[model samples]
Target: MNHQKSSVEQQYVLFKLDNEFYGIDILQVETIEKVMDITRVPHALPYVQGVINLRGEVVPVINLRKRFNLPEVALDEESRIMIISIEDMIVGLLVDSSSEVIQLEDADVDEAPELGEQKDNEYIKGIGKNEDRIIILLDLKKILGITDTNEL
Candidate 1:
């Protein structure tokens, strides 16, 4: 039997929420675009802004701010939607803005802090520190409820 360590690769698309930086796996992301009109849906979750016609397909958009219980901010030109596919479901995450993608070595990622029994902590994968900022890496599987791993 041969015992050896295998290298792990991680690619992240970093974006801003509030004043903090966060990232999600690049493989999960489809595309990013500026904020667009989302039709209001009746009896929908507060975090869910509504659905949009993305190339003749109806895609639901989630307000990252409302989901995280952050203060509301007016939608502006700088706002963007990160369209991602989780288990074949196309979801759009509304973010404050967009940023560059980064390749992170495994060593660069650290465990997320336990913030005293906060419910949302489960969605965070870990914390990544680089240069002058700390990026909160998200657990896409958990956040998106992607049970079929093969689909991704």
Candidate 2:
């Protein structure tokens, strides 16, 4: 008898920032929320928009556009906050929009390429190819500057 190994697929939450597409492992995502009141924290990182009371727990919110040094745009109806859990900490990511969940086989992802820039590849985990679109898979831990979740 011959048996073939089944391929495991990973689920990702896809979102848009500027014109580029980005994906994060679905397991890390807690919930997607509409843009709401964010209380600004003084002396916090510029990318950190502030904190919000999420279901009684305070969570820090980071603006992905500002985090990536991209051009800032006004928030509209499509703006959303993706609450994700990283180890012991829960944080919110401000995104332009989150559309769908996609499944990709391990083979569909390619390691992020060296772009010969200072920090261009710092936060990228890999490049995920789906149909004609190339989704930049983000390393949330790195993007959030989270060295130790316990520190949060």
Candidate 3:
């Protein structure tokens, strides 16, 4: 089998958060939209910015900047929400901007290296570096509290 074709089949939708580019499995993505009015949920986690009404469906939006503990970047014309599903939860991740989907071979993906003492490390699955940029693959299950990591 051709390596590139296999990678393309895996499919990923890439987006920018802070200064980094990250890729989430396209299978998990439901839709993408421009920044919408989000209603704040009292007592929610800081990263959990709030919720938005999507054609009658209430979806929680997460500020990737806050989730990663990075400096907040004010939303502007380029901001977007990438709606993704993890197990049973539908999450909207706010990204600085959306990038094009690039096909990369399995060989291009590698297990994420330990960053040491950073809480954000728990969310990263592996690092995929291409010719010009690195795509930080996310472990959505672990990141969204779907899987228990206390044992690890």
Candidate 4:
């Protein structure tokens, strides 16, 4: 009899941004909150939606659509704020909607395709295959410009 342990699977929080699907590692996500009032900040980056008071902690929020340079659409009922922690910084990412959580083995992920001269693609970690759709896995740290100590 052969007893082999299965490979560990990674979990991801799936969200929608425009018409596309994106996935973020579940470990990085702190919580998901409904769209709330965001206080606008002066002279902030275009992607910075503003700050939100999350249980007393003021968290900076970023609109994924604007960060990705996608066309802007009015916020709807499905809008959500995904609070995630990268390194020691906690930030909120405004997404169209968070649908489900999925698990995938390392083998199911493929390297992101090369889009020459497109700097936006730099934040993509990989493309994950699941059922009939593909999920673009994002490197939250890179997207937020957090450098790992090991990388230094």
**Candidate closest to the true structure, highest TM-score:** 4
lDDT of 3 by residue, 1-152 (tens): 55454433466889988778999888899899999999999999989999999889999998988877889878998999999987778889988999777776788888878777767488898888778888999888876677565767
Alpha carbon deviation, residue 74, candidate 2 (Å): 0.5
User: Model 1: runs farther than 4 Å from truth?
Assistant: 1-7, 145-152
TM-score of 4: 0.92
Model 1 vs. true fold: TM: 0.88
Ranking by TM-score: 4, 2, 1, 3
Model 2 TM-score, 2 decimals: 0.92
Clashes of 4: 0
Provide the TM-score for each candidate, comma-separated: 0.88, 0.92, 0.87, 0.92
Report how far residue 121 has shifted in candidate 2, in Å.
0.8
* Candidate 3 regions with alpha-carbon error over 4 angstroms: 1-9, 118-120, 148-152
Instruction: Please give the lDDT score for candidate 1.
Output: 0.87
Model 4, 1-152: lDDT tens digits are 67486666999999999878999999999999999999999999999999999999999999999999989999999999999998789999999999999998888899999888768588999999999989999999778977777886
- Enumerate clash totals for all models, in the order shown: 0, 0, 0, 0
**Candidate 1 — which pairs collide?**
none
Model 2 misplaced regions, further than 4 Å: 1-6, 148-152
Error of 4 at 75 (Å): 0.4
> For every candidate structure, what is the RMSD over all alpha carbons to the true structure, in angstroms?
3.9, 2.9, 3.3, 2.0
